[model samples]
Target: MKKKRHLKKEAKIFLIGLGLLIFIIIVILIIPKKEKVLMPLFVGLKKEDAIEFCKLNNCKVDISYEYNIDFEKDEIIKQNKEKNSELKDNEKIEIVISKGINYQVYSDNNVNELGRIPVMMYHGIIDKKSEETSYTGGNVDKDGYQRTYEAFINDLEFYYKSGYRMIRLADYINGKIDCELGKSPIVLTFDDGLSNSIKVTGLDEKGNIIIDPHSAVGILESFKKKYPDFKVTATFFLNGGLFNQKEYNDKIIDWMIKNGYDIGNHTYSHADLTTTTEEETIKEVGRMYKLLKSKTNKFVNIVALPYGTPYKSTHANFKHVLSGTYEGESYQTDCTLRVGWESDYSPFSESFNPQFVKRIRAYDNDGNDFDITYNFKYLETRRYISDGNPNTVVVKNENVEKVTPTNLKIIGY
Candidate 1:
């Protein structure tokens, strides 16, 4: 009977252990399993894209942007969330985007990359001589050139209204057209340094230098002062006139450098590079270089061939002009300009050809005032649309009619 009692005790112990095991199993079943997913890498993704990415994964997000020159604007520069975490639905993910390189950066024409820049070419600005002069005088000689002062003012007003802002040629070449100018970049290139181009006279009664408000420099300055964003700057290809004014040349060059403008070689006597001997090319180009450098104490690294000829000169002298010894050190022109009557591709765009930087004639083919109005409309019809990723540039309405990037991933794009 004692043996039977011991056996019974053993059975009772076994049953209690089995019952505890069953209870533990029931508790586990009652608890729901946590759904898990691998977190997507959002670095370099645009903000809109990141949001979409999170949503697809059944996750929520908290997003922010900080100014960063290294990363493209609205690009996901950082993230706080850990990847592949097993979590319940609606877990919050923190994303940080870049505020862009130029954010909060003050600029004369602080602007964005529209993937195209129009460099407008202007010659002379003179008062109308007579009723027969009409806007276009057929005399290509001394007196008949460019447009009337009234016409030039109208051009500026139109540009300002059309959301156009000016930038320097060097600025464009170096891709510094990243300002918030509320418009596309328009470069004003005045060929031939006319007396009226700058025309700074005596000082005012107040001691401020008296500027001819109608001169190219004066008008640009006044307009820029009125609308600071317009940027008081231009690229003047120099040969004669003020540039050759022996007594005033030094002063003018100094003034130009000090006032945030640029000067380029138009060949010493405006010689056509195509027809001129290589020696002439070098002499004409080099003379200006030496003169300009001596005055400004800076590298004169730009040239606009007189007639936009001689894109390629077989002579070594031409090469020297393009890139040769200056002040015992090597210097070269960044690019050359042509009398191309068309808009130039944005330097930032892939389509931009360094070999050919085009410029549109500011005056109409008929030399009418405000002829640039048509060019304005041309730029409006199709413009550059930033892809949020600066590395990728898309010309809107050209290929895709009208399309905004969505669900974008650069890996496949």
Candidate 2:
């Protein structure tokens, strides 16, 4: 009887062990195993090929893009994983694709390649008609320094259609022409900081000063909304009376800076540098600089000469205009602008000088010489056509010698 009982116990133990083994096999079969994959060389491959490889390996692909001068568009520039490395199925393989040569080339007929840039000078933006006002085209003054609101709007539209983009004066001096491909860069500058230039009517619910829709800045903002790519911006050269709005002066200046517009030194009291003595010039330039620095933290170190006097560098007080001290505060100027009647040279040109810049008056003269109509007609073949890359200076093969020597790559075609 003892032998039979021991045999029954052994059978029961064998059945329990067999059941446990079957359960283990079922669990192993139910759970999916992750398949390992050997990463292939994806760098330098075409983006499509890399994606195909990822699909074949049962992996996912995440693509990023960057502008590259060396790699062609859609070519793989870099990969996240190392070549021949181990990866799990469905793992992401991040890759960067090239955007093809950072610069674009336009047909020779479409682009002039490093020609002149137009730096237009403006004053007031009034809302009167030429018949009502003594000035032409509803300008505020007989000199045509102040442009009428309607004419100003028309000018902006003309510029937009003509393929001209607005750039800051500071950027122009720094040789940073950041416009679209094949488009020319133009600058708009408002002198005198008139009440109509950036009029602040009142405050909104949020306490933001309301910009008059009929004002110059207001018109610019409206035009910017109409054409998103217009890049409408201008530099407002201010005197001691910032925009002539004592109540909203601070807020207006702050808003202008916060926006894309810039503020430059128009000299305190608008003193003409030619007639002023060296000390007066220093005080004029310095006092304005100090006032602007106090008003805003980002004051542009540029001065637009009042009345465009002292046109030549030989003026005795010219150095003082460039740099001077006022009441223990020393100030310096990057460039001085003249009330010019012609467009300035390209920043990359050998003749370019930031210290002295020229401007074309924004006025109507029935297409007379030196007017916008005549100048632009002349610039049809002479305007600076961008190569779409700021880092490189593209020009005609013969004009290569005219390019200023710098770290910027020069390409002649």
lDDT of 2 by residue, 1-413 (tens): 99999999999999999999999999999989866788887777898898788778888999899977667788889988998899886898899999975434545435554599999998988876556676666466767888888888888998989989998999999998888878899999999999999888899999999988888999999998999988888999989997898999999988998889999999999987888888888889999999999888797999999998688988898899899889999888999999999888998898999989999998877788587888899888889988777777778778889998878877666
Report how far off residue 247 is in candidate 1 (Å): 3.2
- Candidate 1 Cα lDDT to native: 0.66
Q: What lDDT score belongs to each candidate, Candidate 1 first?
A: 0.66, 0.86
Off by over 4 Å in 2: 1-68, 71-76, 80-104
TM-score of each: 0.63, 0.80
* Candidate 1 residue runs with Cα over 4 Å from true position: 1-114, 128-132, 136-144, 203-209, 240-244, 311-321, 325-331, 366-371, 384-413
Sliding window of 10 residues with minimal summed lDDT for model 1:
404-413
Alpha carbon lDDT of residue 316, candidate 2?
90
**Candidate number achieving the greatest lDDT relative to the actual structure:** 2
The candidate that wins on TM-score is 2
lDDT value, residue 249 of candidate 2: 92
- Scored against the true structure, residue 261 in model 2 reaches a CA lDDT of 94
